[model samples]
Target: MNQYVIRPVRGDEWAKVKELRIVALKDPAASVAFLESVAEAEGRSDAFWQARAEGASHGRAARQFVAEGPGGEWAGSVTVLVEESGTTDIFDQHIERAQGHLVGVFVRPEQRGTGLTEGLFQAALEWCWSLEEPALERVRLFVHGENARAAAFYRRFGFEATGNVVPVPADPSAKELEYAFPRP
Candidate 1:
């Protein structure tokens, strides 16, 4: 049997969503792997999380998938944001094509290296390619240059560095490398 149930998060699971994000922010590599801090996430009101959950749960613009263990524990999560062509991204950068941007990726420490992370990516990428109206051309993700482990994983997962780099907002000295996976 499959070790985990991988599916999009439900709209009503806001509390669990908040809890998992808080946990992710506390991870040892959070400073390099994530853009948000625990303080920033915790300071947000419950209403904000509710809205986020609802939006991701049912929208064509975004989707959040979680891998749950048989014991009902969340093993990891990945969120994909669809960016339409001719629009700017969250960083105010111009997007040349309709595509999926993978973000908010997190897997529990114990779940790492057990193929759980691969499962999460597969689910997210599958969803991205399944969109038809705009017909996604590719899926991309940004990895902090300092985060070597994540960068390696993306490379192994068939995402190639696109020669794009963006300055990390909190620390201008650091950069995030852009990697892309063309639609199959």
Candidate 2:
């Protein structure tokens, strides 16, 4: 693919946002790495997409970035959500301090090896590092244990396994490995 522009997703572009997410959920690797399925995303209403985009576009706790192809199609996307101290139930971990959790990372299969993932991470991390006082101390993500390709890429990006593994909620027999990038 040609060089694409990576930028924050606009609040009003929720329809495109929903479309891209459905496409992402259809990828082969989605079964192992992503939580949602294409059918599920496809069934959501316009209101769902509108709310999601609005939350990420302006919410203080999260941000979403998209990579746009030369012809204006969305090539990829990544979202980061801030998990603050005292939150419970999702991941069931008590936060000792503020941290940014990377999630919803998806890139088109054709765009896999073009350094787009790196650029995506740079954009996500820059946003994480831009947080205000009592600033973020680290960024983390959980990868499926069976996804060796993703795990290796995370390592290449400076994230280290924290020796913490959580069972995937959808598949109890599978485990997700947590990796962290300590803030400098």
Candidate 3:
């Protein structure tokens, strides 16, 4: 219901990607919603952002989608990364199959509940499914156990818990729940 266009981020738009991510990290839920802290992200060099943006821009292994308002404001974003079977995930767990890992999800505070998330997800899913050659069987995401808000949103989008929980990298004593959507 919001007047925004959903599209993929360009390789040259690394600055926008970095800017949006900074905003996301400042959010109240950032501590649980994301694995990186503002300090951690800020410490990275421009080369890191350039590589990230380039990968999402044209690489088959990953893609980032954004909801851009007419006035050039970025309302929201979601990224999908292809995971090959037999590889170790960020959590150091064995990946079971070729899948898409959805991460970096965020929406500007004012843009929440505007259907922007749905738009971003639809784009992310479409890109994931469009990948050929080691086809994806499911799409997955990680949600902090205490972050019921994000978990509920993922559930509404048809992702189900696989009963697998992993320790949070930032706080090993804590946990993050895994949810996934089987490809249709």
Clashes counted in candidate 2 amount to 0
User: Which candidate order results from sorting by TM-score in descending order?
Assistant: 1, 3, 2
Tens-digit per-residue lDDT, 12-95, candidate 2? 999989988888888889888887788889989999999889888875688999989888888899999999866752668778
- What clash pairs does model 1 have? none
lDDT digits (tens) for residues 12-103 of candidate 1: 98998999999999999999999999999999999999998998998689999999989988878999999999999977899999999999
- lDDT of each residue in 1-184, candidate 3, tens digit only: 4679999999999899999999999999899999999998888899999999999988788899999989988888999988999898898889889999999999998989989998999999988888888889999999999999999999998999989999998798889999999999
Q: Which sections of candidate 1 miss by over 4 Å?
A: none
Which ranking of candidates, highest lDDT first? 1, 3, 2
Q: Name the weakest run of 10 consecutive residues (lDDT summed) in model 2.
A: 85-94
In terms of lDDT, which candidate is strongest?
1
Q: What is the Cα-based TM-score of model 3?
A: 0.97
Global CA lDDT computed for model 1: 0.93
Cα-based lDDT for every prediction: 0.93, 0.88, 0.92
